[model samples]
Target chain A: MSTTGGAGSTALVTGASYGIGADIARALAARGHDLVLVARSAGPLGRLAAALETEYGITARPLTADLSTEAGLEAAAGAGLGLSFERTAWEEERRMLALNVVAPSRLVHAALPGMLGRGRGRILNVSSVAATAPVWLGTSYGASKAYALALTESLARTRRVRRSPVALTALVLGHTVSEFHERAGIPPSPPSLTLGSPYVAERAVRAILRRRPPVVCVPSVRYRVLAGLLGHLPHRIAALPPLADDFTVTSYGAPQPSYGTGEPPAGGPESAGGDGQDGVLPAEAHGQRERQP
Target chain B: MSTTGGAGSTALVTGASYGIGADIARALAARGHDLVLVARSAGPLGRLAAALETEYGITARPLTADLSTEAGLEAAAGAGLGLSFERTAWEEERRMLALNVVAPSRLVHAALPGMLGRGRGRILNVSSVAATAPVWLGTSYGASKAYALALTESLARTRRVRRSPVALTALVLGHTVSEFHERAGIPPSPPSLTLGSPYVAERAVRAILRRRPPVVCVPSVRYRVLAGLLGHLPHRIAALPPLADDFTVTSYGAPQPSYGTGEPPAGGPESAGGDGQDGVLPAEAHGQRERQP
Candidate 1:
């Protein structure tokens, strides 16, 4: 929570087995935080925690929990992120809601009181540019992020939290190099459109540690400009048929026939667990994991 | 869903036993649309349905359902609206989410395909200024509405929905004279800040029936202006302690100390179901209700 990096504070990073969450865990550990690393994959989480503990000489606990379920939520929970760029089934959408909305919400609700009482804490929620974009191709994903962004902003602006030292930030992330797209069946964006997890994580941590942390944080300059335009442009112009069509094809792959129907994808919810814009590693990343701090 | 109001088409209204929902049902009925009214109180819903049928010569079917429970959601669903302006318990917050977020989402998800397939329909979601406002006193209410607003906007802008005839509108209502405040235990706003249900309902229906319905609708001119301002203002200025304090006192009454704690209010969720911004009548309004076009 302090500007001097993690110090004696403990940082909990969910979806920490891979990608941005793992990088963030590394960043926080380097800054001297005791870590609780959470992800559905126990092996990766355990390895990440042990590596962080050894490298940073700080305590690191690995917790495996699928935050989409009630019991999972009760066990541990953020970096709650997932998105099906194409229209997915209601069940998948519900799972996305549980991860992207309910999990973070429950975590924040649970954490806020103690943070307020201590008067020294920081809660950073990883959101997406979808939260700000005027035009979105899919259902529920943007809505979920909007919930996260609004929740963080609303709580940050409240009299009690604002007066106190608790810094609440919603990192409105754009495309980052992660397994999210592959896992969700979304075609990956061009390399130019993506940011590295290391850089994004650093900026995210910095945003939360600021004197007056921003309610909405967009990591890179380009994405910040894009987010600004997307947020303010009139819907008519933003959703221009050609522009929207191009975005649809480029970002979401192709329009699936099963969109309107509530048909489950081949693997269902279990297969698509890597964090969306916020970062989570795919199962394969565990074998070839690289740890650099 | 049609520009001509009712005809042979059916419009489903949730929380229809009271306030805005009842008024809207009346408006739709007068316009000649058959109605499916959903609410928790069977008595009030039945009465409203019968009266609408008698007066408008339109089919009015009342279905009693809470919409905050799985059973309730399965039975019927909005007009999803409710808010505890003062910070309430987590249980209350969860209920608010169920009513405001889950209910509308389920309804829209259930209805969209049929509407799209038919190539004609309208879905109006009741949101609030809180969805756009930077400063909020409560935890989940504004966040929930933000989800509603984002969902509406996102879906409306999607290629399939855009090309189709279905109109999706999120009504960003301002202060209205209803039993919502009393039920939620928040003091009422000044009469000047409040708009009546009849006027609001008429405007809401008009918005949905338009050739190109707005993604977001604020009925009153003054509120439209206010919504514009609130949506754009910087957080530093918006959350200026004194300004926010005045707003908190005027809009939400005094701050409650039990905010952080998940303490159940005296009456719990059962007592407070009057729609916050979109309108729902208290139990008393049921007995002394006046039917007007």
Candidate 2:
């Protein structure tokens, strides 16, 4: 690891309380970077901060705020930003826009100038595989992610126009084992999604620091291949817009069924609800029914 | 022409006073869709509304409002919508987000459900070719277009999830001959930008009405081929995140220099100053400079 940060090198990571974000925090801490960990809930963030500090001997401070509201942006601006997800309702849509789209932009807006002045900075925005195209979900989530990728692209360009190499990388991730879906009350993505989260953090950090760096990085060889194919697939065939298991038009207050791995479990339809518990529909799962056409 | 709207087919167009947006309003009026022409200024919009009403015999209402504000969205919500843009300023960036990103999403939010209920409707959002990847522009315009395209993609999926074929088409436009650059105080893209605005409007309406329309329609044949290639080009190569002309990093208040169509202009840099009355960079005017290799 080039370990970009020196004795006092500091990093700001949002959504640091859990899942892929938590793993990223651990990884960064190992790299000897002091961290300002941001998330909504204080308990988990606090616990994670303590653990990281104790384990890696790096300073970790947890800040609890929504990150989607004006106050959230202000707080995050004072600190710095992770990202990711969904639901309906105008309220839900608004929240998704603020968190997934606005917050990250604001956080980056805040932290970027300093890095540019110093002539070296790295920003890793966590986006989903679903961001590349549309998926069958509420209208806002994927769009929000698309906003992130676009923002990162624009900012990176902004830096480049000035000949600044302060890097901004979009981590176009495939599904992984994170509390992401489960915490929202939806089923977990089927195992077919990815090997798991440990690999994601390790690969993401590596990609962000590569010599030429990257505009976007899809971890896991399988997903890298899939992302490449998806890019080339005819737009019509490649995109599978809004649909859930029962073919219901999921909208405000609809039952949101997550897609699972396509292979039917030995226990039949009884095994794969995507919940990692029950109601499994392996064949339809294809593991990626959510995004794959 | 399937001129779908009769009793209430009022097509509200933002930025309707000039450029591609004005052309679209003209085309829609020609197709028998009543028009609600919107722009920041009333004079031009009023004149166009009168002219369209006189020429096409369709109702044209000129509604002047700053679409970057809440009041603007409220006014547009009461009417219906269309879109288009360029430029930069902190205020300009906010307005760009409001118009290009927020406005379209809001307009769609206001108009979509009603269309789905009727089992038909057409939404054509004007986005840029630059949106496919990043360009060297130092602003929010490209990112906002990205937001529009992603929103359209998700909404298209939403309707499909319900099996409702409400048409949603993202017009992925290339640089066209319009007052766009002039209005922004920048030189016109060399004629190579694409066949200009007249083609842009006519082709856009047609694409939105195709029996099997595409999620994104790059208006010209050349651009369509290019968009296809971009989708397949290695992501690293497809996106060139920095620089317009000099390897200088342009900024908010800095003097903005115009990039020629990648060739030395015949009249030298002097002939390319932006206005129609002066420097015309047409023959050598490839609207966009290919990313400096």
Candidate 3:
């Protein structure tokens, strides 16, 4: 982007407390753009905003909201779009949909008109490579990402016909070094699958401001290729993608041996799918402790 | 599938009041399996159950419950699996996730144990070809189906390891003759793109019962081929799929040039994806209310 038109415009960044979202915020700030940072944690968001403001001399405002409830969505809609969900917990899954799918949509609905009215706006919806071809054991998360990508394209197409200059891009990402895996109770990503969060953010930022961005932009050249390949594969995604080694539910209700005692992985075509199924497992009951959607 | 083992076993079917679900129930009755037919409407479910029971000389039970809520899911737990959702309505979308995604997972989670202990069980999760590759404009509907497919595969994998003998299959379908489109207010499906719901059910029943049934089974041979091709294509599905023309938001909040003067389709690569600048565009929001869950 040309610094002239980019500066002074307000950008809204969700999941801005850390990782890719924070880096995107920093990249936006570097272009002299003011920002509204959104995330569940207040302290981290505030600190990130302060750091960006101090470093780039741009105003940065922080808003803490759980992007996973109707009210949170209204607050954020009035708001990356990250994804997380549980197999056993439907309520958690509901909130997961709220955060990953609904929140981005509502935010886009809320932000785009203003951007269009102002004559320039950029909406970058962060999605996953998994959307192209789902990873094993990643039901709600991958599906939700797919929803994000399709909706982004749908809106982009909707606006394109009107010759609206406003831009919408789905930032399709691969495994990045972030808190995602840790939060999901999965092991850390191996080196080969790990893409640096900063690198992903920088590329995403550039694409969003390009003269004409593709409807979907996968960050790294390698990830882009992988995305294409995954999309080509049929439903039988035999093995886990490099980034998805930890994506499967290895140990669910019980701690199963993920590695071999000569045993295949828990859900590895052997260990029986039920986590003691009876009538809505008590652990997965509605009022159970749900994940932070 | 031996007559000895299949005889007298109870079969549970959801969305059984109409379309494929009803057909599947009929097919199950033909196979001599007693039935538990579920749907949102009680009258139709009861009538279908009665008709099937009388024709096939088997017992049938009707259960009417909206499987789109926590209470509904809990009520339907230990039940059948089917999916549907809308793109624009958050309320509908939320319920879609609950029904298409939540209901299936919970049903499987509930039924799997008893199926395992009995050493003989069959779960046929009805998904769509759209899940293999999403048709444009069908956002949440497609995503929820993808979730159903992945989660089904996940649990199937989990059980395969234990030599549990319980069988799970995803019935991947194509556009079929049904009330889905009429209810959604979209025009009827074109003949070339349409498949008969009875044909779909018959095939689904065969595949689910056959030894070594595929984890994901597309009903018709042509649909199977089409499903394969869709899976092969990366995103940027060049044109709106044959099934996708009506998938776009046709009526939002106001009147737009739909038929004449040829305004490119409402979501025709522009309009920035239905941020719904105005109200009830007639092209999408309500008359466009569509589903086939």
Candidate 4:
């Protein structure tokens, strides 16, 4: 694969219906990438694909598969026709593993050969700060993120040996104003305390462009320091009842639902069509979404 | 459920065939605690139990069961027929979670009531230094240990709130002279470079008694410092080419046989009785049969 610096690359983003994933999709498209957006909801993906295609002139394909299942991942990987676990009892757990671990692994694996053949590519995994935190409230979510972090690290490490320009970047995000909080069942913080979607999107894109291995707690240096310090502290000190209580309250008050039912806000950029002949939208169209006033 | 200080108590240890697990069992026994030793192979468990009972005058029991599967953990958790994997998985996961994220939690849960009632108790989890390091190579093992570290921290945090004298300690260990290397298909380094079994056993016992939470690296303080450094470094730098090469070589060099095998050296500890009381063969005799010269 020949590595090109930029402007003609293809990017595939999962969980791209909305929130950080949507923002990432937009950012990559703006930077001239052909996009494949994956999520369970078809409504948002279609909206996103259309917006990207019209606005940025990039090909944006929407794949509405529940990515947390083996079959879903296998299909996404283009491995073969596989059975879906839609009727399985352990569907929830299996889906989470498949989406968070297996799908990403397979997608990266599948995309790597092509990326390598082209000589340059970037895989930006939108991971959460929960990966490093020891809070138990979001156990599965945190563990899966940890797996992503490790996998990304491993890929980044090994890629150097292969001399591939495939950059694996994990964005360790904190609370951003997105559907994630709503899906998680947690109320959004006051406007001053919350992060905006546009800013997060911009930073994520920059990290990928710059090939940062991992970004911990974007826009807040203090939180990053705190996470690092907390991770290193003695288990006894960290486990102190008062501290644990404080941490649980501060870092994990409640789970927020990450999905929302909605259409993209109207008057946004048009959905772009197939391939290279498309024209780029003006950068000013990337406006911030309104949240709790 | 009542915790008496180290004055008198009992602990049941699984996977006590050899290596760190066995050393942990011995360490607890040496502290005048009664012991229940469990392993799939009855031979070493019996022998180790016998030696501990004979030397320390502490009662020792041996029961064989594989811990990774439900049937095994169920037997060890006691034959209460009402056990459900749903509740039991949570409970066991909570306990071994530190073994994986939940062991320290369960220990604190179990030890707190007793420790609070008597105003003192101690629980030590034999964790690896790998808990903090990136698991680029030893993925499952490192992930499990990370869970251990998290649970330990969670419990330690809980201690401060309850004002309980239940001390939770995590002995973050490095490479040592043990069968773990052999089982994991790791070749032993030079004698001076490894922590002798006796040394680790004694140090672990002392740390537990003192309620110290130490990130330990056997034989070299350098390894602890190195681990600390690696844990904080950005994912990219930590996964740099040379480091990745070194890690991959060391971690995946020799393939390990599956976890359990019943065979033991002829006329050695593996031939000992199941009860543990009558298997106190001399250390020299056991060593000659088990260790390669």
Candidate 5:
């Protein structure tokens, strides 16, 4: 922790009411940064903001808005939230574009001038490994993430050319222990394949501080290699019967759910239907309950 | 070559008045398939329809409507044009998505059942290589292409599950000798890097006939390898100074004259502009032209 001018650093995080976004908010708050948390759920955002202020002695403001809509983005930015980078909407396909592509972009546009004037700022867009690989099941989600990565790269290039201290980093993440899977109505898998919440949070904060442009593949390096290899293989080879089946979520556990109609859990506007739980753990949990099953 | 059911086969081609779409229409017509040509410009479409009727003895119906708007798509489909997937979007990013993603999807939704009932149909979507790789300058354009590829894959997967002979192929093309460059206000580079219009048309038609999943890096084996490698590389590594330049078009040369801001070109959308006006020639001859200047 470099403390040169660290007392008043501020960060804004979107989708901060729950999941990876919430965890990232906590991690950044713990690092002595004042926080502005944005999410659609007012209840959860308020709870998390109170908790962060109590635990970290950092100023935490809870902002409720749907970052996917243009109006929502305007309200979030107009609240005078200073952030190193905005991280929100880790999942949810439709909102993924709104939150990941449009919202982050609008926020960045709002923050750029301030950061440039201050001469040193970091912007980390939390993208997923799915962005790089063609995941059949999450087509919209993956495409939005791909756009996020591309946008990050473009901004970084612009910064480099202008010799600006404003840094843009795209943290291409892997499967992490978060409420993401539960929201999607899918049980988490084994720990070896997934990451713990604390681990993901810490790594994300550190990368933001370091301004690293990383395509982070957690737990296993093999996935990174596999994602790369799969992208190159011919469409026929990549879309083999076995591979396609593996990519799709065929069953949640018997009593086969409807193919594409039913809503998910984690009740919100887009919820497919289970319970609206705050933090539902994966099916099999090991050492830490926060780890992805 | 395979005349199994050629006589009654109907192909619906969007933006078929000129360029690659027109060439594709011609190729399919030559193979004895009836055609439905769709474009915003009625004049060129009408001319092409007449020419195809005269030259190949295939019925060519000209249905002029902007495929980007919902109303436009409805009108075109309602006109009772033949069904074939010869869809391509020439310019304007948002329109590209509307035409390429929304309209075609709706059209497919309307036409798929009949094709499935007959147990035979070929749908070919013309997507540029830019779909897989991000183009810095053409952000929206690239995103739209990405959507097309994803949609194609999804449709193909769905069709497979129903055991339908409806084949959806995404032709991931590279640079080709078309008017696209001129319209884009960019000078043409070496012709070896570009395929002639006829060559692309022939290869694309052949691939569609076979119902290939997605054609990538057409005419150049090298581009296939390149696209594969780029897709796999980490964002940081991929964002290195040298590679970024190639991925983005930094500046436009000069704006070409257009008839109207929102209107499609005279004969459908003119393909990207290029220098040579000689009608489609062999790829080798085009290569010779490149070496000259």
Candidate 6:
């Protein structure tokens, strides 16, 4: 490791209460970075913070905040993680947009100048393979991820960042074993296709600490190959009905009336369902039904 | 022409007050489609509506509204158009997200179900080459367009749209002749590289009216070739210093305090700077300063 932060470096991570985010937090803490962990679940965040501080002998602060709202953006200016399922109600979709799209842009826009002034910093935005594949049709989640990936890559290419010591990397992750799927009420994926959280975290932390980290990182070798192929695949071939098990689109009944009131359905605010684990593959890879084509 | 709408098809176009959008409205009207033209500027929209009605013998309803808010989205459920420049304040970025990202998603979400029900509707989202080539570093405009492009393609691949007659096409436009640059105080581009609005509109109208239009449309032949090459260009090659005129990133002074109040800067609302013409090439292509690389 280049030890970009060395010992006293402070790192802020969002969705750090569980799954990939939690593992990443642990990895950063072990590297001797003071940590600010942000997530909506207070109990888990607090517990994680305490555990990290005790285990790694470093400062760890738990910040409870909803990253989708402006107030949340103010409270935790550089924290973000989210996902969206297919066939969600308009309410869920809106929340997804705020968290997945708006939060990342706001955080980056808010953090970059200061990072430039400090002459050193690193931003690692965890995006999904959905960013390149665009296989999920029913939701805007993939599109939101495209924004994250594009923003990170574009910023990295800019003259200011190119000339400076700051680094920006978009981790285009593959599916990982995490609470993300369980929380979304999704069935588990086959063990063969899933990745472990600890492994992903190790790759992520290593990438960010590199002397000149790449603009885009796909951790596993298999996924790196897949991402490269998907990049050049024609829209027609990609749109085709993939080999039965490769990808699929399942409808969860009719889409809820997304127009009308644009209000939350009888349910109160939809749960903040998208955790950092919503990465890689299509629906089948995520354990959804086969494509009906 | 498929004549999907035949003589009385109604097309709602946002940013119809001027530039490529206005030209598109004119083309649709000439094809005998009744028009609902939405824009923030009342004068231009009204004039265009009047002229189209008189010239094409078709109904043209002028709807003046901003498309970056829920109320705006509600007022014109299918209207969308806007752009963003680099080094802008937070307020401008917010509006860019609204118009460039939110408006298209909201409009498509609001209009899709009804279109599917009708079994005959066409959605044409105007995106820029920036959607594919993220050469622009300082603004989220390209990322926003990536959202627009991804949404259109993903939706087209969905079971519902694929099985039905509803068509969605994202026009991956290159730089075109329009008032967009002038409004943002950007200098004119090399005449050789810029395209005329009429040709682009004609191409767009034709694509939407096709029996089986493509998911993406790069209007001009040269741009089509460029978009194809760019899609496959390795990030390292792309990240390298391009041949002087190919691309450049210029800093517009220091970025404003994007985090402070998140309020309008000392100035009121930043002008809705992005129009449909913020397409193709990068900073230099758009007539900005050469990159220092």
**Across residues B1-293, which tens digit of lDDT does each residue of candidate 2 receive?**
22243333666665566555667667777777776666656787889899999998888887776555667653221110111111222333333444455555566666655565666666666555656665523444455566667766666654342366556676776655534334334444566653556566678666655655566777777788766665456544554432132112433233232322221111111111111100000110001110111
- Native contact fraction per model: 0.60, 0.47, 0.12, 0.11, 0.06, 0.51
lDDT string for model 5 (A152-268, tens) is 555455423236545555555555543434544444534554655556656656654653323232224655675566666675566665444222225443222221232222221
TM-score of 3: 0.74
- In model 5, the runs with Cα more than 4 Å from the true position are A1-9, A67-70, A73-121, A134-140, A154-163, A177-187, A215-293, B1-5, B67-118, B132-140, B150-164, B178-180, B211-217, B220-222, B225-260, B263-293
Clashing pairs in 1: A18-A281, B6-B33, B18-B281, B19-B280, B19-B281, B20-B279
Each model's lDDT comes to: 0.59, 0.49, 0.50, 0.43, 0.46, 0.57
DockQ of each: 0.46, 0.29, 0.19, 0.10, 0.12, 0.39
Q: Give the DockQ ranking, best first.
A: 1, 6, 2, 3, 5, 4
Q: Compared with the true structure, what per-residue lDDT tens digits does model 6 show for residues A64-176?
A: 76655777763221111122222344555666577667766666767777677777788777676777865444467677778878877777777667778877788776666
Better of 1 and 4 by DockQ: 1
If you assessed candidate 5 against the hidden native complex, which CAPRI class would it receive? incorrect
RMSD of 1: 6.6
Candidate 1 lDDT, tens digit per residue, B142-222? 777788788878777777777777667777766666354464455555566578867878888776767777778788998
**Which TM-score value belongs to model 6?**
0.82
10 residues in a row with least lDDT, candidate 5 chain B: B284-293
Error of 4 at A250 (Å): 8.9
Cα lDDT tens digits, model 6, B1-293, are 12264557677776666556677777888888887777666777788899999999999888766565777664221111122223555666766576667767666766776676667777777666767775444466567778878877777777667777877787776666534334434444446546776787788777777777778888888888767766678755655544111112532232243322322121111112224321110000000000000
Question: Cα lDDT for residue A235, model 4?
Answer: 49
Q: Which TM-score values does chain B get in all models?
A: 0.80, 0.73, 0.76, 0.65, 0.74, 0.79
| Candidate closest to the true structure, highest TM-score | 1
Q: For candidate 4, lDDT tens digit of each residue in A1-293?
A: 01332655556665566555567678878888777666656787898899999999988887766543435552221110011111112223333444444455445545544454555666655444545664322123444455456545544555432355556565555545534334333343344435565576777666556533232324466446655765677644654443333322344333322222122111000111100000111110111111110
